[model samples]
Target chain A: MKKTNAGKKYAIFFCQQIDKNQDVNRRSIEKEFGPQIRFFPIPCSGRIEPLHLMRAIESGADKVYVVTCPEGACRYREGNIRARKRLLYTQNLIEEIGLERGMLELIRLKAGNNYTVDKLTRELLG
Target chain B: MAHKYHILTSPTPARFKPITKAGIIAWEEGCLKCARCVKKDCVYKVYEKRSLDSRQMLDSLDTACMDCFRCVQNCPNRLIQKSINPLYKALGDNYWTPEIIENIWNQAENGRVPVSGGGYHGPFSGPGFDAMWTDMSEIVRPTRDGIHGREYISTTVDLGRKLMSLEFDSGGKLISSPPPLVEIPLPVIFDVLPWSPGGKGINLAFLEAARNTRTFAVIHQADFMTDMDEYVPNIILFADDDVLKLSKEMIRRLKIIELPDSGNVMAIQEHLKKINPALVIFIRFRLSRNASVRAAALAKEGAEVIHLTANENGMGKAEDPLFIKDRIRQIHSHLIEAGLRDEVTLIGSGGVAMAEHVAKLVICGADAVAVDIPLLVAMECRVCRRCTEGISCPVDLENIDYAWGASRIRNLISGWHNQLLEVMGAMGIREIRRMRGEMGRAMFFEELEKEIFSGMGIKGLINGK
Candidate 1:
């Protein structure tokens, strides 16, 4: 739902759920980079299959990352935890298959934390 | 010089109803002397007061069924129409469905094959042999020289394992597994009938015809793999046995041995490797979406001969024939893409109807083909929908002359061969074998209909695409 900017490398920030904040994220991200980070919001990060992430890379994505809630804080409760496992499994598969594993990353943020977003963004962009 | 008319013609093979016309039988016990039965009750008006002869009743049964049931409906004491015909057994059989029987009857009547001048008219495509059609865009161009300059293309094919080369060792005599190949002058080959019309004469006729044409007839392994299998080395007998059991002294005389679908072609290749590795092991696989994959795998596994077939009627799936051909082409292209196209031989069958069909199939990438029902059709058949109704056969197969049938079949194959040449010449290709899978020499009807026809000829097909 949200559009991001091109201040940095092409990266996907997959959100756990799409909401009014998606517009907020799109505006702020675009305001920063115009059209760089492409945010794909799903119903829950748990629904993302590893194959989907692999396919995204195969189709020319430089990097992909999932944004879930901080531990034990997601409204869907166990969904964020599932997303972490899926992400880890996918990263391992890519490593075993001799692809760049660092390209696939996961970052967690509390429900109402702007400071965490900036910090995570700083880490991902770095 | 002349034209033909279509009257009461069917789109598929014409078959006859298994039941012959009804015969009049007199019940001596119930006749009040039946004066009314002779006067107005006979539908065919064949009833007369004369002494009834059982032989005459049988001879006159010729599909003239009144079915009024007048005698049954009007019998004051209920008598007549109770003729017990032994031939009633002719109607029901696995292959000879009531519909198949009717098609045979139509063929029997004219002593000629039934045909539809129009395009196909069935429900959906069928399984196996009924799903494909050969592409024929190059059909009309005449590059061959005949009387003035029309060339004649031959439909003959060889049925033996081909080899890259052979070598010897040990005492330096030779350690070669020279595969036996059969060379037929025509592309048509006799196949095991869909129905087992277990008549020695019919099989003999088929064999005799194939022999005469320098081609081979295929009999199921079930036929001669037993007691009566002493000789007849010219006939290609297909069996499911391991090649080790097939080591007979007359190995050189065998034309071909169609391998059964055992999923393990390696054992077959290994067995043949003992004798002549070139012993053609024709792998018969049915047509399907995965046929290309299957074909590619077979070629990879060292299959000598690969056969892709639909069903008896030329279809084996519920998809379009073009779609099926595409599937086969993909497999062929996959082999080529994988740089293994020359390793195995390809044969396709089913849904190959016209002479143009042969060339088209070759273009789709088959070295040769195996035809089924069209053989019977060319010998005279209509695909009627009746064979199992406890009735009699309208067509008297017992009385057909085999020689006449063979000539008609020969004419048909010969006609097709010339057409193949016609298409090949149009594309400026001299050798047909080289034209296999050459898409550059063809135009899919759909493609042409879409791109070129949007502005050009033919009033009906313009879709403004």
Candidate 2:
């Protein structure tokens, strides 16, 4: 499939435990997108505070996405659940400030889905 | 010993961007992207400075938006809108309301009394503590400097038994030795949380807060760690079955100990006292239907201190549960009738969520109150009870930084202390001890409504007259 718009800027914060491999494969996405996308790996999605998401937008990312393990599947047990609440809270906060709610997204990764970081990035970007 | 008690406070900022009450909605697909776009024309520059918090997936726009609605008005495509944030509305439960949680969060973060800015906007009376109004008749008095005034209002309270009468020998030096007493600078103590994601960090935080505020924290003996030795003075170990196992040195180090009320509660108190004569023993009992009778019996049995605990919502565990205030009143009056009210200290716990509650509970006959949930709320707990379900805390309380947690709790206690002083000063009382069981200084809605409207034909009309 064609990659997302080259001009749109996107930032992805993915939980480190989501994939079996430690490597996030950021270089491939950067090579194709040419720095239009940025990747941040967090220990757990729950570690993502509302301030971090707000700061990302302030730093010029047009869209921010948080990728985490599916509900009740997190190794830390409820990190993803909490991450979802924080995402919705932040979304509401930004929406109040006259910003589009679509700028922020939470992507829950299913177990054994065989989804690649590049594919997820492309999907979020699109 | 002097009556001046002050809580050292410092500002502790929130780690996360708090969920705001309102959010704006603006459609971007149909944007004209005009040179004078409504977004750019924002007086607060909310749109221009809009940013995403990549870590939390939060947008700065919501926090930065001043709720001016100018963008909505000027949007050529009419795509801008504003509404209350559902997430903000969803915080906390019926007992621990969202506004209460937010107020505690603000107090903890800033170490300041929550001034509503405008005048009181809430109802005149409701249920529980809300149904009673304190006499702020002294508000018109010029000497009403409660928190920061030159004149000091004492919040100090004493624990343990006091002799009703004193006797002296023929010799001037001869006198009866007074019972061991423990005094706290504040009229509040840290009670065991009803439910928590247990960890050493949380316990240490409570202990540290108790030490900082010169109050006590009731900790289960099993939860106590050896590293907590430094805070031994501020710790009240609640021994269930571990009383005999505690070493003499450990028992001696503790100033006060609590034993569960059982058939042999007096024997337990006696055995513990024999182990450490200096230790002030507290009989911890659940508030139930017969709680007042039990409390009176305990007092008459020479119990030095009695800790009556209610449910999380301050209701007794019964078919028809009585509120904490009423239960405390019953216990207080029963003790007074038995002439044992002056002998034993009564510490009430449960449903003490706010600073005003400290005053209300005291007026209801408690010597002091032990708080549980407000401390958690100070540490940013939403009271979601996910921890009770074995789920990880949304705020990650299990691994919380003890220093930050302690400061937050201290800040909360500080706010409560100031509020207590405000209530006391407003009642023209200089000491918290005098505020205890002073029911005349407070108005109960049931009593007032009955007195004013019972005889005006309203009762008969309500009965289908």
Q: What TM-score results for chain B when candidate 2 is compared with the true chain B?
A: 0.91
Model 1 regions lying over 4 Å from their true place:
A1-126, B1-143, B146-181, B225-233, B241-247, B250-252, B273-278, B317-324, B385-392, B398-404, B425-428, B452-465
Encode model 2's per-residue lDDT on B116-150: one tens digit a residue.
55589777787888889899773465475587778
Cα lDDT of model 1 by residue, A2-41, tens digit: 2352333444544434232442334344345433454544
The TM-scores of all predictions, comma-separated, are 0.50, 0.76
Model 2: per-residue lDDT, tens digit, A18-99? Answer: 6544232544565566546767655567657677788888888998899988888876567788788888989999999999
Most accurate candidate by TM-score: 2
CA shift of B186, model 1, Å = 3.4
Candidate 1 lDDT at B371 equals: 65
**Which regions in candidate 2 have their CA more than 4 angstroms from the true location?**
A1-126, B1-3, B27-50, B61-78, B138-142, B453-465
* Tens digits of per-residue lDDT for model 1, B369-461: 776555655554433222222122124333446655555455444444455555655565655556777866655655555575467665664
Predicted model with the maximum lDDT = 2
What lDDT does candidate 1 reach at residue A81? 76
